[model samples]
Target: MEGISRTYPGRMHIAAMHPSTQEKSWMTALQHLKRKGAIMALAFLSTTTLVSAAEVTYERLLNPEPGNWLTNNRTYDGNRYSPLDEINRDTVKGLKVAFTVPLAPPSVGAGSFSSSLQGTPLVEDGIMYMSDGWGRVYRIDMTKGDRGFINWIMDPQTDPEFATGILNNRGVALYGNNIYSLSPDGAFIATDKETGEVKFRVETQQNPAEYFSMAPLAINGKIIIGPAGGDGPMRGRLEARDPETGDLIWTFYTVPGEGEAGHETWENNAWETGGSATWVTGSFNVARNELVWGIGQPYPAYSPKERPGDNLYSNSTVALDADTGKLKWHFQYTPNDSWDFDEVGSQQLYNAKVNGEDQLLLGHFGRNGFFYNLDGTNGAYVNGEQYVDRVTWTKGLDPKTGKPVEYTPNGGVQTYLPETRLDASVFTTEGADKSYCPFIEGGVNMFPTTYSPRTKLVYGLAIQGCAFNQAAIPEDEYLTGSVSAVDTATGKVAKRLDLTSAPKGGAFSTAGGLVFGTSANGDLYALDDETLERVWTFNVGTMIDAPPMTFQINGKQYIAVAVGPGGVGMNFEKYPARAKDENAKSMANFQQASTLYVFSL
Candidate 1:
């Protein structure tokens, strides 16, 4: 019983799965599985009754037990809000660190950019599953509440030489009898949950520029995966595969093909490599059978003239049919984008009353510095507002259409505030007087936002300041952070809490009347859900660049997050003296560590 068997059951070996160089070793492993799986499956069933955990069903994902953190962003609404209330406003004052588990070494040389803990750890039953930057999955036994011990680890052994982009493995997925994950180089691997044996490994990387970073979203017996590196010369796509056998089901390319519906948006053959990467975990609406995902910036992000016309899918939110991967509806937030504003964040789905009528809405914090609420069913513009300090790119959204005021009717290229945009034709002192507003990172970028049904307010952590275009500085241009609580019903900010550090780390709300957030520095704190007042705080001694999550165990609730210091940020590198506020100064120093910290009352 102690060491029964570890062979993959019903292991599969698909022809031409891996690279040709590794085919021999792979076939050797497949032969071993074929030879030993039959005997080992029997041995596993007959021993000590240490059976594997139950499969994660679609119903469970829809209505997950309050204690278990099932899917990424919990139940797929992209609302990181938990129903657990054991540690409420009255009890959070006594919350403290319960335990810690060390993970793989942080930011090893996996790519050109270093890695960090940009993932949200997933918890099930009493055990925990998460991935480090290098795609090593850790299975930690947490049934013993006092501490967590590593039960097993499954490493994909991704080659850093071929991993070209960021090394951030945002986490993994749990399905039938296995855990699913993507290596840095883009190999999708499935591991047996109970024994840590790999069931199958499918090569997903198509080119060196295309890499996997976000966690896989498993829903309705299919796993959805896409790649990053849209900034490079790579065409982005989203693929849905059969979870059990890793068989490709369907593909949705962000940059439409020549004969596709939206292909006319690109004048030249830019669609071949026009980048609109899908890099974030999307939300699933079970009732509507829709998968809502956000798309990234177009290639040559800062220079939109190279690719004319309003890029079809870049800087947009597209809803697709969950079963067929067919695009249902799309709403482009920034058209012909020239601000490096990639809308590849979260597309939160929620129902709220608008103008005295109940409406299902898709809310988003645009990287171009705006808050938008669109009709969920058809992607129609419902409401829009400027949540950040200012947006210099455009005057504002048109009241009727929600498009930028400067957007032309049928012009091939957009000229939204040439003073703030990067254009070669502009020649004016006004253009020289200002750089860009809300910075290129936006009101919020890849870091997630939270929508609390309890408060009916969507909270977004945003970098509130602006950026200079080409080293030209305006005295007022600076960088800072703000958490804007936008009223979901009205699409207006209810409250804005200014913070001392730019919140690269995201936020999550709880039914306990709290919103937990991490700082670019080292502080993790809880805020009153309604008032946005800091109620409690703890510094992990290193920066937290991951989203904080909560789960309950044995009638007790614990808050968790993946933490480490270095990331691709201004703080991670040396900067000149421009705007030295508490936010900028504190970000200058941080120790490096990759750890899982759990806290409870």
Candidate 2:
């Protein structure tokens, strides 16, 4: 038989065989071909048999098949819940580390020394796609070995200055044969999935200071993204673009402008500089054809006197016509919020039995410490309750409207629950110290929560703390975080697991009666979804501030999480008591690094 060798472009080439050594080398060459063929067959079978592996379609995104994480939060509804149960509570204890991939820091000039692994990796067709804090996209092939190998890394080369602080990206989006990434410096890039080549780059912002750190949401041929930088002087907005061409389809300003709806809420041109940034990926209602996004705090966070009235769209959830980008309805959670209480957390969509009737509901855990259930169709308030231990900003929410009890309709310069509001005198004098619960970082921040239809419960990480806000002195603070299970119908926290250390990570719930979360102290935890009891724990030897995801390859299940520190981890000194624990202190002491740990049963 004649020995032959062939090479595929951008892939490994078969070794050339010599006629003299054909007997020995030929056999090895055949074996290599067999192995490579098996891998190619597996990839072919996965793409042909698995719905998610075929193509990133709207139908698949709306209802992703089990074992695939299509979007940042797993589904269009932003539930972050997977139906896969191969590695359930019964099997989780036996899970072992399958592999660990240490990622390099973002390029030399990417940013400050601070870099984090914050993205919720998206897995499809045996390929894993993720982004680092500085917007570098990486694609890894999981079908290769027991330990997967990185296929390619696509660095968008975003501005280094924009990569500072807590404004880095949380993830990337996948579409038909292409991956979408929004850079820290406001560039929207579409990269080829197979070769990791940049397809096109579009500037999303005109202001050099404005940027986008959230993952783009791809739906029905439109790529949706929101702006960040509300902490400074920036007007936030959400835009929809053509997925293939990166051309603008439409744009909706989070903070309305003069003569527009909600514009009157800002008194003296505050609307021009309003800071209601949409800092996280939002939930989509496929049936209603609407998209709901959470808006951040107003400009000059911590000082509401700069802008008056209810600050209409700030600290609110707005529903827009998905295709048209027109506002359908909005519900403000905190009017004229001054505690830096941004409502910019993910909105979870679910169908629930409310008031004895099946209703479409939009659920949210506000940074101000309230759990709200609203009518998903029209943005009407259905139910509201406190989901945290301490909430001093308001006595409670208005039972009918779901607004803070102290909120005055069209009110000016709100000082809700005077004692809890930031000392207005801070603008002038320095003596008064105002204390408020659910400290500034919020009851929940950028970390996305999860909802399980199987358990009919919503799981969220709640930060509990009290901050003393004075004029010039640093606000004295004490904080702790907890994992809470809330009932969908009643808007009540059904159970809570308080971590000895603060929690900056989010959670994932599975049909197998398990909820997975990581602690600030590098421990991976699997808790009983019903009882909220700890079932298993594994220390990852570093800080974990990113969410955990579950996926399957070749019928075996795996759990993956990005481990590192530095988003909210830098605030370890603010909660001394919470960090007193050995594990907590250790995590606080660890330096930041970019690493991905995958475990399997």
TM-scores for all predictions: 0.89, 0.87
Across 1-601, the per-residue lDDT of candidate 1 in tens digits comes to 1112233443323322454657567645644553222211110111212224677887788888999888889878899889998888999999999999887666555454676788888888877888887777877778778788776677665667667787777889888777888878777778887767677667777777888888999998899999888878899888888787777888899999878878888766778778899888889888888999999998877668888878879998999999898999999888888777899887899999999999999999999888999999999999979998888889999877778999886838898887677753122233454567777677898888999999999999998777664436556555567899999998999998997566777999999999998866577989999999999999886667788999877888999988865456533322212234544445455556778999988
List runs of model 2 lying over 4 Å from the truth: 1-53, 106-113, 162-167, 423-432, 469-478, 571-580, 583-585
Error of 1 at 67 (Å): 0.7
Candidate 1 Cα misplacement greater than 4 A, ranges: 1-52, 423-434, 469-478, 570-587
Candidate that would win on TM-score: 1
For candidate 1, the 10 contiguous residues with the lowest summed lDDT are 39-48
- Candidate 2: clashing residue pairs, number: 0
TM-score result, candidate 2: 0.87
lDDT of 2: 0.76
